[model samples]
Target chain A: MFHNDGFHALDRQECLRLLAKVPVGRVVYTRQALPAVLPVNFSLDTDSSVLLRTPASSDLVRAIDGAVVAFEADDFDAVARSGWSVVVTGRATVVTDPAEHERLSRTGPRSWVVTGEGVFVRIESEMVTGREITVPHSTD
Target chain B: MFHNDGFHALDRQECLRLLAKVPVGRVVYTRQALPAVLPVNFSLDTDSSVLLRTPASSDLVRAIDGAVVAFEADDFDAVARSGWSVVVTGRATVVTDPAEHERLSRTGPRSWVVTGEGVFVRIESEMVTGREITVPHSTD
Candidate 1:
């Protein structure tokens, strides 16, 4: 990994690739003005939208829709002292149109919760960015 | 794990225990009024406060002092369909007291970032809560 400035700045493609590689991410949302982060098992749609399934009646389901939120995923090598983290800031919209619902159902993610329900929310990336750190070498 | 009032509520002691077990966590802070979650390697202090090391000039270190932030960590068993996530909402304070600083240096977390600096911030938990889901025996 090469550093663009001080930290490695990942391009759009690499960011999407990393997002697809990790099934679990934490979604940060503001509810009643307090920031809350929830772990979600999500999928990356072909169009590069982050898709997640939650129950229709859940508060998370209601809070994320039309709200600006962030989804983050990372994999770290603790022993090597390196890792990559990607954060996407976006606005979420629930799939309510029948055609979109059918299409998403065929490609959207499944929930990790035991009694998982089938309410799908798609977060369209408004700003996608990432940073990565590599194991330090003596010569560098 | 069993659920109380439809959510698995973890007690204070159990929450701190789990916090110590996990070396990595995500710290959620508001940056320019938007919520951002950054992965952090943290340590639990004897007083049950969460501590981490970041550079003095870093935005996180500067913004978090006296601000409310959330520290989250979790362990999940995918195939078993069970896991617990703990969220600690607290106020962050920079370690400035010399005697306390010396004591913390012996116990505070070390940074994972290459060329790690030693600016310490302690997050005192005001509210601790967790949720867990168990395996489903019935096929849906």
Candidate 2:
């Protein structure tokens, strides 16, 4: 029953549920002086952050390492007439620990970039927010 | 028709085409010794560049005002069992001209963030790359 003008605060369970449903999302960060947004494949971390895979040679790796970032995911079906979106904003860390990397790498995405490519970055969200879109039910 | 190890060099037209079909993507930036990635709605400009509307108050705006950035878009269809992705690396500029903003704003998108939100940020690409997921296609 969320309205357009009012933000429906999301609880932990709702946030997790939304994240599980959407596979692709946007990651926003600053490169030089303007905002840059990129499409990424991510898995939800056990701690509730977004885990993304990238190549070491990737510009995304270079530009976003050790920076503040935002990660979002959503789904819409015009025919079904329903959709939802979730956003996770926080600081990102490059996972260098072999054991941790190995664990994440097992479940992380295979870079759509290239073969022998690897997931070099990981982001842990500090704050999460979400909302949904639905046709207003008519009482008539 | 291009492949390098794993990276695919996608021309401008290919990037624009794929970008148009996808609705969610991520933005990456660096701030305070960490990397940040956020999801956002975006469009391909007439110049075939990536443009995003964001809140002026957002940290994304503060990071990209005069910085280097990168953008990405991708499409995935489980039914067709096919997908393609485009990545743009470049510098970002905030569009201030009313006419330009208004014109670009007309394209399709329903930003979850507030309007009067912030100025629009556009990325002027220097390098673009793309790839298609093919079960039979091998990089080796």
Candidate 3:
């Protein structure tokens, strides 16, 4: 569950539900005390990890050098005055085993960057948190 | 004009048009020699800059502080065997100035992450590149 200051908290199921709606997300990493975030298309692997596809020379490839990373995806609805978001802090790694890549192939995005050296990345969630907002009067 | 290694390259106008159709994209940032990318909903500003709304304390906010960032959005058409993608690489800064924030507010996403310290992070594109792929007939 996610709670901040005084707001509604969301559970794991709710978090995954909202995440399933969006195909793309941002992966956060640090470089020389500087921060950079790049967006990528991903799927939720059976192990409940986030899988992404990209080409070589991508900053994503450069930074993943075997380390835990941060991944996030979100959307909101102003008309309903309500929305939900989820964050997954996990360890990101290149899926080197061909079988794992083949398994990920089932649900990932249909297209690649069209650039060679394409590869897939996976993040195993260490901590998942989420939040929801509701503005009752605004809906009317 | 973005053509590399024998593929169709998309220009600035085409990039904007394509980005308008998708609600998700990845935001990649670097922290201490590591790279990260997250998904976000963004709208194209008048000058074709990337504008996204995020709450305070987001991994994005903390990680993307005054750094070079890459913002990417794409649309894929499977049946047609064609798809296009646009990538904007530039420096990102917090839009703290009230007036600029106001202007961006008009062009920003309809839903805002209702977390504390939500500020607009605008990426001013220094370089924009795009590509498209049309698969050959496999019936042969």
CA RMSD of all predictions: 3.4, 6.1, 5.7
| Poorest 10 consecutive residues by lDDT, candidate 1 chain B | B1-10
Ranking by lDDT: 1, 3, 2
Model 1, B18-95: lDDT tens per residue?
888877899898888787888888888877888887766677876678898888898776566567789898898888
What is the number of backbone collisions in each predicted candidate, taken in the order shown? 0, 47, 35
Give DockQ for candidates 1 onward, in order: 0.40, 0.23, 0.19
Give a tens-digit lDDT track for model 3, residues B1-140: 22332237778778778887777676766645445455566787878788887765556777786878888776654355556767888888888899887776665664334444367888887878777764452331
Q: Write the per-residue lDDT of candidate 2 for residues B19-90, one digit (tens) a residue.
A: 778766655556554445544667667776678876666667787767766666667764443577776777
What are the lDDT scores of the predictions, listed in order? 0.77, 0.66, 0.66
Q: Candidate 2 or 3, higher lDDT? A: 3
lDDT of 1 by residue, A28-98 (tens): 99867776888878898878888987777778877889888999888876666678889999898888898
Ranked by DockQ from best down, the candidates are 1, 2, 3
Q: Supply candidate 3's per-residue lDDT for B30.
A: 66
Report how closely model 3 matches the true complex, as a DockQ value.
0.19
Q: Which regions in candidate 1 have their CA more than 4 angstroms from the true location?
A: A1-7, A114-117, A137-140, B1-7, B114-117, B137-140
Error of 1 at A5 (Å): 11
Question: How would you class the docking of model 3?
Answer: incorrect
Sort order, TM-score high to low: 1, 2, 3
In order, the candidates keep a fraction of the true contacts of 0.37, 0.30, 0.21
